[model samples]
Target: MSPQQKALILPEKQGNFKVGSRSIPSPGIGQLLVKVHSAALNPVDYKIQDDGIFVTHYPAVLGVDIAGIVEELGEGVENFRKGDKVLAHGNPSIIDQGAFQQYSLTVATSTAKIPSSQSFDSAATVPQGLDTAIAGLYGKHLGAGIAPPWAKTASDLEPKYPIVILGGSSSVGSYTIQLARLSGFYPIITTASPNNEDLVKDYGATHFFDRHLSGRQLMAAISEVTDSPIRIVYDAISLPETQSVGWGLLAQNGILVLTLPPSVKEDEGKGRKAVSTIGSPHVPYDEEIFRSSWAMIEKWLSEGTIQPNNYEILPNGLEGIIGGLERMRMEQVSGTKLVAHPQETK
Candidate 1:
């Protein structure tokens, strides 16, 4: 094996990405060195390049969703063995662990083995998006505080409650929909482009509305579906307009969880609240919660409880990621994740 690996490197803050060489890193205790077979693109990757957010160093490597084989396991890492297929949530804050490279080191707690039924491309689409959903739904201080469905003591009785998910066609939104269903949230409602209505529905959204629907129109449409209080609204888009819509639909005391910063003004003394979520498990407070959720991923995928986002493989390997991220920035990627194969970089 080459001592160095090809990586798509951002040479400076707000700089362009280029295929460059980087040293392969070894795993630390409680971590694993993974051969990244497939990497999925996200909006945050472009946002980092354009806005220079999250990363403090020059030549930053950015990407968060990865699926591959475990090449080496660090001390105390008992869950995965070398050569086992796995999917992990990449931590872009650390250069050696970023997903834009052919190999990366990942914390064992945030990594899960891929079930035999899923492919690397499919599993690559799950980590960041699914973790965001988990964080927003279950992170005690960061989320809506719903009980996780995978808990052994969890009640299987279906709760006849309503949950609204904004931007259901997005990678995170789609995962949010599936987790909502698993928690027995009744009449799972979401918004998406009319053409992709079926896609969100297939992910367990009980009802889908056109994304262009006005807040008033969406409220009326959703009201007809169920009069149950809309206690949780997960806004995957979290744009100003979407946040306003979600805030408007939320019942008193309900939480409006946003993937981005809260945009709408809160009503005084209304008891409704808007909270933004930090998706990565590396957050000090969030690791334990995400670790528990990550433990369930393999079973979730194996049983078809959580389906991965539809994906398109971008050409040119790691170099192709630049165009993919650009398309995401332009909002051209709808309802599907764009994936790249780092090993194919030339």
Candidate 2:
């Protein structure tokens, strides 16, 4: 194996990305060295480059989703072999584990083997998206405190409530819609542009609202569909406008989960709360919660309970990611993940 690999690096805070050589890190205990075949882009990747957030180190390599072949294994890892196909939640905080490189390292706790039915490009879209859904729906403190459907404690819920997921076409939102269905949430309502209504419904959203609808219009429209009070709203978009719509729709004591910082303040003394999700499994608080979800990912993907986001591969390998991030920043990307093959890096 080569001692060095190509990587796209942010030379400094808020700096442009440049392709350069980086050392291929050795796997640590309970870790696997992966030769990344596919790396998916996220909105946060652009945000990091533009706003210089998340990474506290210099020359950062920012990427979270990963799917590839396990080139080697570290000590005490028994579930996988050296040549297994795997999908993992790469820890972007550590440059060596970032997925923008050809070879990356992933802890066994957050890695899962890809089923034969799935491709590396498709699997690349799952890690961050699915983990965000799990964090928003099942995190004891961060989420609505619902039992994970896959867990033994899962019940039909004391009330079998309905849920509203804003921006259902997004990667995170698509997975949220599916997980909502798995949790037995009836009348799974979501908001997306008209073009993506079918896409959201395919992911199990029972009802879809045009994203352009006013808060009042959406509230009245949803009321016509179901009388159930909206007890939970996952605002995957979390823009100020979308957050306001979600906050207005929530019944008292409901939770509003956001992927971004809350721009809309919650009303005081309404018993309604708004919280944000940190999707990385490497976070100390999220370790146990994320590990529990990661254990079921392979089965979920294999059985078709969880569908990957529709993805479009970018041209030019790792170099292609530069243009891809620009498109995402401009909001030109919709309804599909942008995937890049690091092996094609030049």
- In terms of lDDT, the best-performing candidate is 2
- Shift in Å, residue 310, candidate 1: 0.5
lDDT of 1 by residue, 181-236 (tens): 88888889999999998899899999999989999999999989998999899999
Every model's TM-score:
0.97, 0.98
TM-score of 2: 0.98
Tens-place lDDT digits, model 2, residues 1-346: 8799999998899999999998999998999999999999999898888887888888888899999999999999999998899999987778988989999999999999999999999999999999998999988777776788877452445556789999999999999999999988889999999999999999999999999999999999999999988999999999999999999998988899999998877765289899998888888665677888899999999999999999999998999999999999889999999999999986
Task: Candidate 2: give the clashing pairs.
Answer: none
Query: Which portions of model 2 miss their true places by more than 4 Å?
Result: 154-156
**Count of clashing residue pairs in every prediction:** 0, 0
Reference-based lDDT, residue 306, model 1? 89
Q: C-alpha displacement of 175 in model 2, angstroms?
A: 0.2
Poorly placed runs, candidate 1 (over 4 Å)? 152-158, 267-269
The 0-to-1 C-alpha lDDT of every candidate, in the order given, reads: 0.91, 0.91
